[model samples]
Target: MTMEHGRAAGTTRKPKVVFVLGATATGKSKLAVAIAKRFDGEVVNADKIQVHAGAPVITNKVTEEDMAGVPHHLLGVLPADAEFTAEDFRRKAGRAVARVLAAGRLPVVAGGSNTYIEELVDRDNAAFRERYDALFVWTDAEPEVLDWYVALRVDDMVARGLVNEARAVFVPDDADYTRGVRRAIGLPEMHGYLLAEREGGAGEEELLALLARAVGEIKENTCRLARAQAGKIRRLSGLEGWDVRRVDVTPVFACMKDGGAACHQETWRKLVWEPCQEMVRSFLEAPGCRPCSSIRPARR
Candidate 1:
């Protein structure tokens, strides 16, 4: 991989990557698309669920419309039943970043899957530091705020055909949930309800009860996932010394919950979008990394 536009004149510089990372449902993906547009960049998915094929609704994969025509890699490219690991992600993500750099575009790795990020960024910190200048942006919200938003998003997903999408991938006889798209949150949560409905021997009231229970489980599990993801980011930032620039987007969420659609857009630009644009601007303008005794970030 070579650094093209990220370089200055004839000077060879390390390839630059900005990671948009944080807990689920924190608008990380949307912010990433905006960043890519501002910086002539492409997004590479690091979210494990999103790598699997199909089940977009359940896995919460960003759609083409959401991606806004920005080139995306490692997203929805794996077979639905394939088992993917952090090591697998590291190899694929490295190639994806290289391809973006070769095309003279900045590379933005965006997702909630922190292990994949860790594998790519920290597994070989010394060599990684030598080869790339990286900026880590953590888009965060208050835990309580996120708890509300996640449940709301799960409802929205269901309204947008989450149950049907999950049904399409449902396996009635087999309930392994250990690997592949079946392991996605919505699929496992919906298993009991889907199986019961498919079997067609249950009463109407019983089916409704099971379905409601399934939806509740989906919401609760997703909330738990957001918490776990946040914990991982904390570990990476604190124990591993990742220089993560955290931007609390709680205002954006709070406003969305109460404000009109028009106000929502305005609040987003002011509180989340504009600030991130400036952060990436400054990082790009900064000099590339120099070899040092340590790659650890200074304590925040």
Candidate 2:
């Protein structure tokens, strides 16, 4: 189904959807914003954790200033305590794409939440099969380098008051970490530290040790999550037969280590931004291009 743009006999022409998918801390948000600005599109977050309200530091959500006036949907729209299932996301995100299409703008869905993204993009439905044109641009980086990057991000989140953010929603006796935003990597790891902070106000040295251990655990767990996410992206690639254009941002991270933030930005523009923009432009204009799902193409 890589031809006829996914059209079928008696099938309605569906809207085009661009996807920016990758592991955590690989700069998917930045690239999504860049693609939106270039193609006059809006960003629809597919990250399940990011859809919850608050815990922005923990989730590493795109800040308002970073969005640069580009509209974003399904981002922090749900309550932090609310349960948002994959089916919930499928319904809402479908509406979001429709709204974007109604305004005659492209839809760029971006997030590391591959399961949620898969639910929305690969669901078996007659109208959905006939109605979507998907182009995925996956941003990836080497594990060692990206693990370092995610560690740095954990430190940055701490500096941004992640402990206090978790404290706001921390429950003392609750062992169930599988619900809502509490499932975020940082919060679950910090459970021990949060307990110490709440119960033992006098154990100065022990509390500090607990806090440090919690932060370290957060970094380690976050790196694990990133690896798992990368693996899931690979799984989706094989299972769904997607036409994925991968952009490696390892060089950008390396530049940051050698030069600094400025150098990293310059390297990113060259390695990640420019190529994605060109790819997006071609995707938007290419004829006979189609969403590479398993759906059989209609006979002409």
Candidate 3:
């Protein structure tokens, strides 16, 4: 079942699975969709928040109009209050990949959830037993640019009714914020604002102050998450060695909001997608090399 170079028992090789991973607000989802379109692939959601149902604005789910009919899976399927784990994701994602392969379409797994992506990379997982190569595309942005994007996104979320979304989903007694969609970024930070609103008697200025504080906390927390994500990637890279590819996307977001969709798409195609295509192409054409531990020299 293994594919060595271009030959697999003299049969044509299958497309490699592509994993697009990065911190939140790094444009990973956008790139995933575009790559899927270019490569005739389907995007499989790996973000924990995006997996839950009915919180598109809160979770920043890719919109239907924005999807461009590329077909995305595992988005908004789980109940917001339901509990799920990395093992659960592995099982579901395996089934999804199998289905995508059965339909002869490439599977592009994309999200900001590093743990979920790492689980898929684990060889013990069923997804890794299919005898197909996987290409890990790590999307990145400059720290300052990422900060700007996260702040802007938080502001936009507030303008688009994030407060109301928090109000609707907030549970007064639910202190276990680590469970289900509650674990989503930005919710716990809004606790103070929600509490102040429910307590009443606060002036408009005071309410605004509370919201501003919450917004700041959201940005800080997101940056912290990005740092932790980077640490995990570093550890994983050390273990996986040459399997990881990093792509800087700071410029893509720099002009994304200012009517630069077409321009951004072209830039991404040239910088990220094209390089990924070349890497995977090279891998498919090169003779497969076994690990050093698995090699046994012939006896003299």
List the RMSD of every prediction in angstroms. Answer: 4.3, 5.7, 6.6
Worst 10 residues of 3 by lDDT: 291-300
User: How does candidate 2 fare on TM-score?
Assistant: 0.89
lDDT of 3 by residue, 219-257 (tens): 799888887876676566555422666777776777675
The ten-residue window of minimal lDDT in model 2 covers: 291-300
lDDT for model 1, please. Answer: 0.83
- List the candidates' TM-scores in order: 0.92, 0.89, 0.84
Candidate 2's displacement at residue 13, Å, is: 6.6
lDDT string, candidate 1, 179-270, tens digits: 87778898888888888899999999999899899999988998898889988887787744356777777887888889967877898898
Between the candidate structures 2 and 3, which one is better when assessed by lDDT? 2
Clashing pairs in 1: none
- Name the top lDDT candidate: 1
lDDT of 2 by residue, 119-209 (tens): 8877855344357777778888889999888888889899999999989888889746887777888888888988878886748899889
lDDT ranking of the models: 1, 2, 3
Better of 1 and 2 by lDDT: 1
C-alpha lDDT values of all predictions: 0.83, 0.81, 0.74
TM-score, model 3 to reference: 0.84
